[model samples]
Target: MKDRAIERDMDWLVQVFNWAVRFRDDSGRYLLSENPLRGFDIPAELNPRRPIVPRDWMEKVIEAAGPTPLRAMLVIADETGRRLSAIRQLQGSDIQLGRTDAWPHGAIRWRYHSDKVNKDWLVPMSTKLRTEVDRHLAANPVLGDAPLFPAPQNHRKSVSKDRAGAWLLTAIKRAGVQKLDGTLWHAIRRLWITEHKEMPLRERMYVAGYLNRQTMEMVYEHIDPLLLQETVETRREYREAR
Candidate 1:
């Protein structure tokens, strides 16, 4: 993999690593946990900052995705901030968890069986995306063990990394993000938590399936876009005396 894609892959791995940490019982998960990847042992050139797709860019990307299941999936991801692992595994049973066509709470649930969070994950489901998803599920009512996204039809029809990347590339184009590097599914997850900074650190960790804040802050420090943008903008208007 090239340097650009390497960062993308690392972002993906970070989410997986985080999940693995959460899945494991207390005792230090692995040797890597204690051994810091920092310091002179690390090469200077590897200290590159990974790029992310701006939220505004995500809007365009969703528009550009054209007509495909991947498009709606990306839209749900951008709005809900779910890991692709959970997003791809969405099913009628999952969506129906504590929701209804009438209530419209704009949140969804992820079952442990199909989640990398490998437990239960509850996330806000945007109104717009839910309409689209519900429509799709309505068409395919044969809710078998398979997920809504692309999975092999054979015995172990799990989602493959290659297919995940392809679906994401299409979303990247639709999102209209210009980057020195590309983004990954996990980046979408980080974007959600980073975008919601004021919501109590622990709550963010629970929402993202992180065992704690130290690890959440470790990877999310560089993502500077805060959840306060709306508040700051509104206050600015008030201060302006218009």
Candidate 2:
């Protein structure tokens, strides 16, 4: 079996053993003491790499997308840091365009089933993204229940994930940019998270729909190499002051 599969099976076995121990005559005392996956090292390549998309390259891709609805979709993904699947699944009713007293710039309430957390959630959209979405909606009006980014060939159906990805790839190629190894959409998400590193942990987690700081750190945070020196200098200054 593959290393990852082996690791998963080992983890499952450990959980099962621990549960079985709870019902034993000795109770929790006889539980497995060591992790079954302790020694096995999965290849680094097996893990997901959270790469931040370069802002310049992203701008070029967006420009290459022209005035299509796909461009709006890209902008939303970048501005709001929402998952591509969640963004693609957005319907007209999922967006709120009215001018709220609290937010005069307008706002969007994105309600979608998040594949990552395996749950449905409503997240507040960025004001800029909401404005871009408003423009897209005004230009290409659809029914309340219809998809915001409907398939070009079928108005009733939402754009397929593959088609949306292909659109992005075509734009990337047109802009003379090389595609990153991992999903392009994820790179945009990473870029958003990286840009907001200074935001409070709670607020960042809330915006990204992450349940915990551990998940945010493990899956979302990707510090730019360009900022490494600055980060190190800040840390050094703080330590010296203390």
Candidate 2 — which residues are off by over 4 angstroms?
1-48, 112-115, 118-124, 235-242
Stretches > 4 Å off in candidate 1: 1-48, 97-107, 113-117, 139-144, 152-158, 174-183, 221-242
Q: Candidate 2 versus the native: TM-score?
A: 0.75
TM-score of each: 0.62, 0.75
Cα lDDT for residue 92, model 1?
49
Q: Write the per-residue lDDT of candidate 2 for residues 169-240, one digit (tens) a residue.
A: 888888898788777888888888888888888878766666668867767778667789887777533455
Q: Residue 64 deviation, candidate 2, in Å?
A: 0.7
Quantify how close model 2 is to the true structure by its C-alpha RMSD in Å.
Answer: 6.3
> For candidate 1, what is the TM-score?
0.62
State the lDDT of candidate 1 residue by residue for 94-182, as single tens digits.
66534667446555667786555468866656568677776666654526555566464542354565776786686665565663354
